[model samples]
Target: MSTQRVFVARLSGCFVFDPAGDRLGKVRDVVVIFRKDDPPRVIGLVVEIPGRRHVFVSIGRVTSIATGQVITTGLINVRRFQQRGGEVRVMAELLGRKVYLNDGSGTAVIEDVAIERNRLGEWDVGQLFLRRPRTSASPFAKGPTTFASWSDVREQQNPGEAQSAEQLVATYSDLKPADLANTLLDLPEDRLIEVAEELPDDRLADALEEMPEEEQVHILEALGDERAADILDAMEPDDAADLLGQLPEERSEELLDLMEPEEAEDVRALLKYGPDTAGGLMTSEPIVLSADATVAEALALIRRHELHPALAAAVFVTLPPYETPTGRLLGTVHFQRMLRYPPHERLGAIIDDTLDPMPAAASAAEVARLLASYNLVSVPVVDQAHRLVGAVSIDDVLDYLLPDDWRSHDGEPPAASAHPTTATIPRRR
Candidate 1:
């Protein structure tokens, strides 16, 4: 094997020439085997044969790696390359991942990794070429490129190595879920799955909710059954139901079976209603307390950090049992009402019964009008028996009222301004 040092990025896409200087194939992927105690070792190259298919070229045959070209022995393996356990691909896996500087003052995305062989003939990551994130006023202007020794950067954890999705996401943790979702969309399927697997279920759920329905389904399918189900359980029941409704019945049922029974039951109920109905747009989980519960209890429920803002706008008070579809609707206590009343005041005393709940079969148009006319952020959904079943949120109503491709368009308007400054425009003009 050649002992020449070369940046994996430069080698990628470079044409391979035989000893006689005849063009053979272009480098498609650089293969490496990762080890804990030493750097990942480069093993071979996956090259795309001109008129044929991809084939494996052993590093041992390479005579030299120079700018834009790889000179190798005429001998080549005709077999197609298949990645096995412990093998990592540089261009496919590492190039686009975000990496932090060891000093923590700056960060750069791995544009390419440099690989070189030691005296012992083992390949190692020798250096890294980084592309700093763009912050210029002109979108087309390129960002500065900087080089760093592989050792000067934070550890680059390969997939199936130590599960670095969390580390990768943690670097962007300051970003809102929607912003994070945009970045995740740029990744390839396999890389997307690896990163999604490491994200906390709640975070993944939030990000998935912000993505387009097609993209959402794509990620969920890539997530596999168990992990996908866990993320669904963490999402708002209405959003979870919407996604499930888009999937095939068998796959939906499999995911539902994997979810926590309580959460699954709520989503199942939503699924029973047509996508155009009020019930389908409502989240089954909301702050529901007994009519006799104290103001302090209502305050505590509203303060729970996990409650979605729309759901937390008000606390629904119900009679007996306090379970969806079982409890009789009493009234709702707006968050402001809880704040106005003394902690010892009974919730029943402050319940606002002036506003009536919408029937489960109410059309989306009707739901929208009701919320708008009442200037309500959320309204309860009730069945024929007048039992409280769920609450339709303003966001959910908007989702139904907007055009089907509303999320796909760029710069028309933002769906949710939860973090306005961080919202990404789908394209640059």
Candidate 2:
């Protein structure tokens, strides 16, 4: 169900080739090439060949990759690639560069370089896979591997040059939001902070929301108050409140002063509620629209805003003052249901009236009951005024009630001791 990607460590040793099925060789090393003044990119892969020569392949010209093999089509041959001056880049030089594979389709980090044996009894690169793997069953956080796997990448090129630790941090841009979330959690704290600083603000917020609360603290704490405030400014109001609530109250006031008044006030509103209560768990952002507009206009808003179709599927179509967050709540319109109507149909004409909604002040247990009944990962929360206040996600409830229950259902044996955990809940807030 999660579209999360893995780290590039998994795709370290894929085979390589050009047109005509001419075997070029496998990736020997990967090198990241960021600006001398900036972080390194794991952008180049050093290829090993049958002859005494090697070449570095860029993200371009990468046609496709299957398992451990890289497929590319080009006018030039392997011989010309070597003569172009990329002989010295071995896997030892590119430890932490970013790799923007396949013309920047996605991103990934270099975790480790793996080597395997070829059919001729000679050692060759095998697969360039991403590092981290995720499952809903894992404890509140994910497990680890320094080198990422290829599956974590949304797109990738053939055998990329191997990297050595001394080279610099590698960045891969080919991952989806969820994938980036897992990778961030899996990365070492220092490395994760660097990636977090580079991520787009909205995306950084989404990834943080999907992340376990513990990791949210680790990354923010590492960034210190100044940097953390910059990222928090871009997060949804409720999410920002939730994150701020996890820190010591003394630190909260200092951070509040650092935020803009509007952003600060939105977070303060949610901070007033107990974390386990529905009010504490609602999100303050929504793609709301007037209920009287033509269905066409409402649909246009969704596309223009680039909102998640699932979250904005049913526009909370209200009445009047389309420009302002208003007081009237006329009704709701399912995006698909609206699309089926004639282009001239009004939103109110096509609205459904049978939906049951929850109040913001309800306990999570009550909200869960509704979610279970409706099979929803998220549910809207409205205030005493009937206006939408926030939304709650399934993970929030599970964290409070079933952190360890899932492991029992999974029939997992006693956990390995690499990561120790406490049974008694800590009183932090």
Candidate 3:
């Protein structure tokens, strides 16, 4: 019934002892189940039995783990342990693997793993200790050990290993879009694009949106005309336009031609404006309604949930037949006012005429100032002809206001080597 924490490295090759202090065998590997939404949990230990085959010992039968010994509850299973599809063996698979820390540091080899049991009595990989793999060992040689939380580390595929693109695709397919994007950034450029090509168009689009602009262009262009067009069509029109704008004009036009006419037209319309202007920054898609539309109708549209919160911040009411490049622009209805109005009331009845729209040619700085000064979450952009072109969200405006390299800096120090340093984790005792 007793429990203790020990690093996987320390546990490996340690003698396993039964209740009566009789040595059984050495610990071979730690088994864990990998799940997308939850931390991996230790299920059992693989221990080599003397003169017999390797067997699985459930953690429930483990009394303690520390130093060079694992004390068990005396009852251990004799059958061999089979690794299931989702199972991972920390000692066998991960111990010597290279990983990238979130701080954009170069790769480090995982040396040991720290495991702890949660309140629910499930052991989870909580921390990792890393060190540069040494070519030779000496009694007097000293080096720094790096300590990091498990969540901050991501496994980087080894290039020297003969891993097929299909295998790599299968390995990364289950990761969340953002996580997959982060892992892809650690890959060499050729491999990055190669692996991306194998992914489903929708998944690839999601991952591409999370990558840096330069990387996005490189991947999309390498995907070729049809695949690139499919992914761009899958992405938000505004995002697709921004990426295409980064490519050479001839290339961009060629890719645009390959895209579905409707989708390509939307992006082409966005590309007309200068990158620093309001039209360039705003999404052409936003929640819009006729002046006579009811509050109930507006709520229904918002409930459909296709629009992001920033995109639905306010409802713009227009005259006559409403469309993307809409008819005569009427007053705007801020989101707060929508909540206060009766369900049956018309949007035009409660619209705010005092809020002026920004011109499409307005500079990014001008747009940021307007949003900040007005305390607005979104502001509409109108062309010289006063047609409703699009709306810019505050988040987009802030991206422009911040430094160009803000994405790279993120206010965190890049991981650099610490010479002759040791981590604060407890030493063997």
TM-score of each: 0.62, 0.56, 0.59
Question: Mind sharing the TM-score for model 1?
Answer: 0.62
C-alpha positional error of residue 208 in candidate 3 after TM-score superposition, expressed in Å: 2.1
Encode model 3's per-residue lDDT on 112-202: one tens digit a residue.
Answer: 7888876676688877887743445886663467888777877767666532354345555566675567556645555677678778898
Whole-structure CA lDDT of model 3: 0.75
In lDDT terms, which candidate is top? 1
Candidate 2 residue-wise lDDT at 6: 19
lDDT (C-alpha, whole model) for all candidates: 0.77, 0.56, 0.75
Give the alpha carbon lDDT tens digit for every residue of 1-429 in model 2. Answer: 322221234444566766556665665444443233322333445554443234445534455544566665532223213312232232333344445544443555454444332343222222343334334575666433443333333323357543223222233355455545754554444555766766666667777866667678877777767777877888777778888888999998888888888788878888987887887876655556655578778777767654554456667655544322335555667677887898779877777656655677799899889878976666666667766665566755665676633322122323322312211122210
lDDT accuracy of residue 113 in candidate 1: 83
Question: Lowest summed-lDDT stretch of 10 residues in model 2?
Answer: 420-429
Clashing pairs in 1: none
Candidate rank order under lDDT: 1, 3, 2
lDDT of each residue in 159-253, candidate 1, tens digit only: 76533343355444655776567546644566777878878898889999987888889889987788898999999888999999999999899
